[model samples]
Target: MSNIKKIVDIGDKELEVWKSGKGRTIIILPGMMSSLAEWELLYEELSKEARVIIYYRAGYGKSDKGKIPRNCTENAKDLYALMKKLRITSPIIIGHSYGGLILQEFVMKYPNEASEIILVDSTSYGAHKLDEVEIEEEDGSSTEAWVEKCKIYSSLSKEVLQVEMAEWITEMKKNLSSSQHLEVEEFMSNPVMFESLSEELEHDLLTCGETNQHKSFPNTSTIVIGRDPKASITEMVESEGLHRSEAEEIELIWQTLILNQTKLNYKTTYIMAEGSGHSVHLEKPEVIKKAVDSILNSTEVED
Candidate 1:
C-alpha cells in the first residue's frame, strides 16, 4: 500500500511524518538518535493491519532543528502540539528506547491523549540517574561511558559518524533497502541529529526527575517490552568494555525498572521480545503486532 509522507508544522518546528494502513490509529515514536527509516519494516508490517504513523522529531530526518536544551519535557510538549495539529486522539502509542521516556512524560502531561501504550525495550524512567551516581563497569570504568560515547558521536565528522552509526542497528535494519538505508544515512549526516541527541542525553537526568515529580500517571492500559539479555550481553562485554557481571547487573536493573513500570499503570502487560537486543521492534516485528492485536482484541471484548 502507498504511504503518505510530508512535512507537518507543529508551531516553530516542522516534523516529517509518514502515514499508512487504514484501521485504528497507531503512533510509533523512535528512540534517541533514531528516525522513521530504522523501523520502516515494522511500520509496513503493522500498516497491513492498522493505521500506522511514524515521524521524525526535530533535528532528525527532514524535520527542523529545535532549540537546544531539549529534554523530555520539551519533547513532550512538541508531541502534544503535533497530535493536536494532526487531530489525533486516543491513538495507540508505541515507544522504543528514548521514545518510551517521552511516552511517560506525555501520558503524565496529557493523560487522555492515548488509548494504549507499548514500550519496546524502552529506556527506564530513572535510568538517567546512573549518570549522576556511581555505575562502575567491569574495569572500574567511568560512570559516563555511555555519555562519553554520545559526546564522541557529537564530535565526529559526518562521514565518520555515519560509519560509526551504520555499524549499529545492522541486524535490526537487515530488511532495509538501499534507498531506505540512504534515508538513515542522511539522518546521521545531519550535524543537528548528533547535537540534539547529545543534548537530550545530557538532560536525561532532568527528564527522568521531572517525570517522577509529576503526579502519578493516569490509569492507562500499558505494555512494557524487554529484550532477551543474550541478545546484548556479548555486545556489552565485547564492544562496551563491560564485564559480564557488570553487564548482568545492568540488565537486572533494566528488567526491574521495566517490571516496575507495570505497577505504575492501572492495567498493564509485560512481554519479553527475544532474539534481539534493545531494538526489539525491528528484530521481532511479529511480537509488536502480537501486542497490538492483543490490546485491540481486549478493547473489542471490553466494548
Candidate 2:
C-alpha cells in the first residue's frame, strides 16, 4: 500500500499527517511525547482495510509548535481543527495516555463528532485530583521520573541521549527493533519538547477537572483497553527502582481510574491486555486491531 504523508495547515498550526488505505477512517491521537513514526505497526496492519490517520500533534515531532497554555482542551481543539480540515466526520477515534484526556475534551465539546472512542491505557478523568482517590503519596511518584527525564534531555548531547534512550526503549518494549527508535529518539532529544510536555503537566489537573465536568458524554460506542497493571507495576519497581509497595500503590491508583471509565461511557467494553504494560498498542497490537475491526464492522452494519 502507498503511504501518503503531507502537511495539513489547520489555521494556526501545520500538522504532519500520514494516511493509508480507504473505506472507513481511524484517527489515532498518540501520547504527547509520542512520534508519528512509532505508529508504523498499527499503520502496517490497519491500513490494509481502513483509512488509518496518524499525525504528530501540534508542538510535537515535526509538527509546528502550538499556542501557549497547551492544555488538553486546546489540544482537543487542534484535533477538531484537523478533522474539519480533512472533512472527516463520525470516524473512529483512538487515544492513548494524555491523548485520552484530549479525546475526553473533544467528546465533551463536539459530542456528536466521533462514531466511537477506543481508549488505550489513556489517562482517566479526574485521576489527578486528591479527592478522586483515598490513597495519596506526597513524596512524588512517576512525576519525579518525568522531571529527571527533562533534566537529562537538556543536559545530554543528542547523540548520547539517542543511544541511551534507544537501548532503554528497546528493553522496555522488547518487541521494537532499534531501527524504529530513530524518530522517537529525535523527538526526545529536543529540549523544546520538554517545554510543551512540562506545560501539559502543569495544567493536567485543570484539564482533568474540565473533562470531569462532562459526566455524561455522547452515547458513542466506546472500548477501553487497559494493560495488565502487574506488568506495569513490575516495570515501575524494576525499571524505575521503586519499592514494590510503592509500585503496587501506583498501579492500584491507575487501575481504579481506568475501571471508573466504565461507569462514564454507555455500551463500553473493557479489556485488559495480558502480558502488556502501558504501551498496549506496541506490545499487543493484535488486540487493538481486533478491537478496531469489531467496531468498524458493527458501525458499517448499522450504516
On TM-score, the leading prediction is 1
In candidate 1, which residue pairs get closer than 3 Å at backbone N, Cα or C atoms, i.e. clash? none
Which regions in candidate 1 have their CA more than 4 angstroms from the true location?
A: 129-175, 210-212, 238-241
Error of 2 at 187 (Å): 1.6
lDDT per residue for candidate 2 within 1-303, as digits (tens), equals 998989999999898898999988999999867766667888779999889998877667777776655778788898999999999988999999888888877888888999899999888766565233223353443454455565556566767766757765555344555666666667766665666676676567534555447546777788989989889988877877767876787788888888987766667899998988888888788888999989978877988
lDDT of each: 0.78, 0.78
**Candidate 1 lDDT score relative to the true structure:** 0.78
TM-score of 2: 0.86
Per-structure clash totals for the candidates: 0, 0
